[model samples]
Target chain A: MAHALTIHNLKAQIQDKPILNGINLEINSGEIHALMGPNGSGKSTLANVLMGSPEYTVTGGQITLDVQNLLEMQIHERAQAGIFLAFQYPVEIPGVTVGKFLKRALETKISGMNVSDYLKDLRTTMDFLEMDQDFINRYVNDGFSGGEKKRMEILQMLMLKPRFAILDETDSGLDIDALKIVARGVNRARGSGFGALIITHYQRLLDHIRPDFVHIMYNGKIITSGGEELVRQLEEKGYDWIKKEYNLIEEEAHEYSTN
Target chain B: MDDKGIVNTNKKSVLFDYQLNKTPKSSWSADIRKAAFQSYTQLSWPTPTDEQWRRTDITQVDIPGYNPFAIDGAHEIDVPDSVHALSLDNIMMRDTALFQSTAVPLIRKRVETATDIFEVYNLSFFNAGYFIYIPENATIQNEITIRYNFLGTHALASPHTIIIAGKNSSTDITIEHSINNNNVYIHGLTVFLHENAQCRVNIVQNISKASYFFSTGKVSLSSNAVLEYFEAHTGGSIAKTMLDAALDGSGSDAWLRGIYFGTGSQHFDLGTIQHHNANNAHSRSYYKGAASGTARTVYQGLIEVAEHAKKTDAYLTNKNLILGNTARSDSIPSLKIRNNDVRCSHGSTTGKLNKNQLFYLMSRGLSEKESEQILVQAFFEDVFSHVSGGTADKLRKIIREKISDV
Candidate 1:
């Protein structure tokens, strides 16, 4: 069966300041979409709001996972409904070992994951990620290097196998080798039943993963959507060409003045 | 006194003027009790104005309203034959000289110099007690457990426990305080570790929410002695404990860990002291707690290094988690260092559940309650790592119960 995550006229704010100004997008289970934007472009906010982060209030929006209303559900309920968000800065959980945390998460998701089978699956997944066997005993992301933290997030995504995943800058602070590892984790999860919205600022990550469609977001809204040529153009000319073409500087000034 | 050895007297009059009915006049404990009674008369119940009692108001404790329970009969306990685990009254009856030589002097000193009203009160009117002596150069493979269970209502259960670790000996002991509702469990304990002795002591206080519990104790370590002290306060409407570790000899080391989880209207006040009087002493203390449902938890710790104690290393860390909007936690860690060649530091953090951390867990498909429960369990993992065997299992069970209640 196929799943679709749809967002219609999504508008959100933090405290009283508006961030996501009517975000409209639709992602099917099979395709990978890359969301590119400059800093403070509401790309991350969109990802957070999709996962129902309490930090942001959705003043006007409707998010749905197939037939289920995502906005009406709690954060964890959305996750149980197969919506995963790979945090840009994953929070460190002290004293919780990777194996134990993953075991609990997998059990909560799958409900009937036997211990031996879970361990076997975990061992294989961790091996594919090149995580040391002892990594299972180590605390979750506590004192982990930047590259290692990114891999840990990808490791969780692979183990969870969510239907729709939003990678919020999962490629931000990674070297070439670490970047390849992350891309490999995501590629391994790609199939007719899995979809992802990869959010990043650079084209290097998209070069490795190869998104089918690219969307450029500026001033809290997607200004344009196109094919691989769009990513190539942005990589070559930067967001300035889009700003000039869309003529958004004067509108941005007015928006800031209203805020 | 009744035939059951229960004291029959006016509660208030007997609170001030108490007589020892079980012990002979010539017994060592009797003399100590008589001496403690004199000091008990000069003391009064702690008031809210007192600095230590300011956070926990005891003016409404109603100490005299509860009858003094006499648990002189057989207790529910099991131990090995090599260990000398006997009730204080039994020890005084069978071996009077042992009490006079070892425990009587210490009891006298604590009572005569007592500043807290509960300390002297426990000494003067204690109806139940125990004395465990680990022989010299002996290794006790099994853990020695002492269980004190209160069964009566409106009764004051005061018990004294004395543990003497002989030279070059090693052992682990657990003293549990379990009680019924509408009772007061006040206790005094002393542990003396001789030269080269290594001992681990676990004190678990789990009482009914309607009861009040108080514990006061001192642990003295001799040269080359090592002490691992673990305490868990997980019950009672109001619980207060004051335990001090005295490093009286060189090369002594003490590591202390404490944990408390409070719920409902429970209030817990825990006080700890690390006193280094000799050179080359090392001590570390870490205490963590969580509060929910309008509950409150307070941790007061002091690390004191004497003037003559050079090369003393001491550190203290306390962390608290408030699980409810109205829950509260207080952490006060202090240091009094007199020597210049010492290393000492202290830190404390009181906070609610980390929102980001919670969100991270919730994003992993755990419900809010399950996430908080896991976080609370992880919060005490460092301290919980120090204990093992039966005591650790019991602590984990209590933690699960407390977290589930929240």
Candidate 2:
């Protein structure tokens, strides 16, 4: 059976300042959606608020995964419910080896998983991602390059096999080669039981990882929704045409940037 | 009376009782004990005005309130034929005729350097004692293990351990101390490393929660000798230890590492000194500890280089983790370098758990408790990596137990 994630009339804020004015979206398994927006347009805010980030408060909203309430669940519970967020800045944990940390995480997520089977899967997934076998013994993100950190995030997503994933700017600092590797890792996990929300600033990433639907966000709200043609249009004319089409004032849009 | 149930008592009466009830050893041993007792009488307990006693308060600990001569337990000593492990009584009584020609002089010469009141008390009235000696040019293939298990309540016990490494010899040794019921335990240890010797010593102290513990040790190294010393302090209501090492020969190196975990209302005070008196000598000391549940811990470290010791290198580092709002820790690292061409540095850090780090782990589907357990264990990995495998596993088990109890 396919699971669906529904968000209706979502409003959120950080401290007293409002960030997400109102967001309405629905995603089901076996589909991928691309969310493109300029800087400070509440793209990242929506992703973080979906993951129950303590920094953001949900002023008014409703979010549900199937029959379970996502807003009422804790951050870790959301993760346990098959919601994964590939962070923009992966935190470094010193002295915690990648192999050990991932194994523990897998055990917690699937308490009855067979150790031998998990080990075999880990080996195969790492090989598929083109990660060195010795990389598992290295400390988690400690002294890792930017590309390595991003690859580690994808490796975790594949190992955990979440139902829905939110890729929050995972391609910002990657070169073309690394971008290809990351896209390959995500494509390997794409199937009937998987869904993804890819947040990006450029259409280059959308070229490799094709999306079924596209949405453009501005001023903390989704102003337009369309098919893949929207990505090409934005790449050609940039966000200025969208601003001009929406009749948005220049200073009013720039005000969110200062915040 | 304080929480430990200690009350004021006459110190003189307790000393006289111990002297009357003690068994007779060799004539020279008796003389040494008598001299130590005389010196102990002239000294007084450390007051809060003293620098070392400023953070820890012991005004209510009266040594005479408990039975000084009560002892109840046996020790397990495992060693190879290359090593000579003798009880202090066996060496001082049965082997008296050969005492002067034996290795007893190495202990006697070092024991005379004690000036602290607790050190003198341990020397004057030690109920449990052992002497370990590694002969010349014999590299023992097996490790030596010595364990002292005491199960007595409301008792005052003193234990002494002396180890000597002969010329060009090498060995690894572990000494463990534990108690079941409430008691006052004062311990003294001395080690001598002769020329071209290598020695590694690990000391583990895990006493009862209601007990009081005090320990003093000095390890001296000769020319081209190397020593690795590791200590773990995990138990006891009040624990204080003073461990010092001196590099008395050129080209010698000493690496000292220690870890401690305190819970409940326990208190711990740990001090170490790295003294360099020879040219081209190097030493490093790394100590880390964690405290929780209203507990308190302190680490005082010093690196001293003499004026004549040119090209001396030393480093000292201390890190502490406070597990709760009320738990506290203090770290003091100092360096005194007299030579102009020496490199020495010291650093100390104390902090709570990183919230970002915790959240990162939690986001991987682990609960708050599981995340904390992983992070706390990771915090001590750097220090544990330097220890032997079996000992490190055992220490990690103790830390895991402390975290689970929370």
Candidate 3:
């Protein structure tokens, strides 16, 4: 049985500041969704909340992966349950080399891979990401350039092979060459039992990895959702039109409340 | 004062007397010992009220409960062909050609009384010790190794070592202190590097956690000499060590890397002083430590540049990782620079494993403990890289073992 992530009326906040208000989304095991939003419109918050980041407190909502309650598990438990987040700003861990950290992670995520085969696969992924094989021996994201950090995030996703991955602006800092490799990593890992919620502010990434569904997020909620056309409309209008439309909706609600 | 110091602890005096009577008398060392003993007798035991000994309290430490004697004999450790390695007592027992060539002058100047009381005790009652002499312009390919193993019911064991590298000579030396039974452990070391000499000292101290361990040492470098000192301390219930180094020779260089792993209720106090005495000398000290389980650690490092020492470069860094809520680490790194032309900097930081780093590892599916263990190992890797041979690997193995119990 394949897994499907269902988030119902999700509400979350960080430091008592509300980020996600009544966010409802679902992605089947084989579907890819593009979550396009303006800056500070709760896209990153949703991804972080889905991974059970301790910084984000879920004020109200129910999140489930198939029949398992995702909210009931700890952060690592959420990872073990197959939830992955590709951070926009990856952290640097001094003294911990990339190869060792990934090996430990893979051992827990996919325990059956032996050392020799794992090394081979890791080499392949490094090669695909246009990274030097020596990088696997370097400290995790320690002193890495912006592009390298983003590529490393995608490389981790490829290694973990999670059932669902939320890529939060992973395509922002990447050049076209690096962006293709990241898209290629996602493309190869797609379908079967894998799904992804690709969150971004631009349609450039959607051009590489097309989403089955598209969503427009504003004011901590998804005000509109559609297919490929939605991405083009937003990219052409540059979010100003969406802001105007959401403003009209807010004005209508306010007037109705007053009457 | 002697009676006042030893008479109250008669059991300790009997052990000390047996040790004193057994040491074959040599006028040179006897005079040195007599002076040191006088200082030791006059100086009262330091209490927690005193600033230097404030972090290290000896109220619970008992001297009479243990014994001390000759713990090493002839051929107890194999001596490589290219180096002269023998006990100081043995040299005092029989005046050897090597003694005349190397030991006579260094022994006279090495183990005299210092300012500290415990070091004064080391100068007075070191039960056993070794002296290794590397001949001038000679290179010893094999590392000269020595061990002082405490066995039987010894209440106190103080083994000392003095290493002198002759001019233009090069060698590696490893001095390890270990114990199979419970006792108070104290070892002393004095290293002398002559002009153009190059030497590396690897000191590994791993006593049973049931004992209290203390080590005090001083190293002096001559002109154009280079000394690399590494100390890896892992065991002992309560451990304290002070390493004072003087870069006395112009163009001399010194590198000190100290790494320790403390767990349980252990209290570890590690201190170092880099004294820049000559112009154009370079010295660096990097100390990394971790404490978990109710353990506490204190690290005090100082880099002092004398007034006449111009163009000297000295650096000191102390990094400590505390694992649990009950575990604590205090790092105090200071500098006293008297020369304006010198470059000296010191920094100390005590922190836990980064929570974000922990989450990054945990997000990769590692348990919290596993994440912490990896980060802890990573935390010490900076210092481990300074260690060479199988010693770094050995330290890594011990760290893993300790982490399993942390």
**Candidate 3 local lDDT, residue B155:** 59
TM-score of chain A of each: 0.96, 0.97, 0.93
Q: How many residue pairs clash in each candidate?
A: 0, 0, 3
Instruction: Give the Cα-based TM-score of candidate 1 against the true structure.
Output: 0.93
Error of 3 at A211 (Å): 0.9
Q: Where does model 2 exceed 4 Å of error?
A: B1-21, B96-103
State in Å the error of residue A160, model 3: 1.9
Model 1 C-alpha lDDT per residue in residues B154-247, reported as the tens digit of each score: 7788998899999999998888888887788898988999999999998899988899999988999999999999999998999999989999
Report the C-alpha lDDT of model 3 over B20-131, residue by residue, as the tens digit.
6666665345665666766776677767998777898987776534555534323245467677777766766776776666654654565453767677677677767888
Model 2, residue B80: distance off in Å is: 2.7
**What is the C-alpha lDDT profile of model 1 across A1-259, one tens digit per residue?**
7999999999999999999999999999998999997788899999999998999999998999999999999999998889999999998899788999999888888867899988888889888988888888998999899889889999999989999999999998899999998999999999999999999999999989999889999888998998888999998997778888888786674554354
Clash pairs, candidate 1, are none
Which scores higher on DockQ, 1 or 2? 1
Any idea what lDDT model 3 has?
0.83
Residue B14's lDDT within candidate 3 is 58
TM-score of each: 0.93, 0.94, 0.92
Q: List ranges where model 3 is wrong by over 4 Å.
A: A247-259, B1-14, B26-32, B70-79, B88-93, B141-144, B152-154
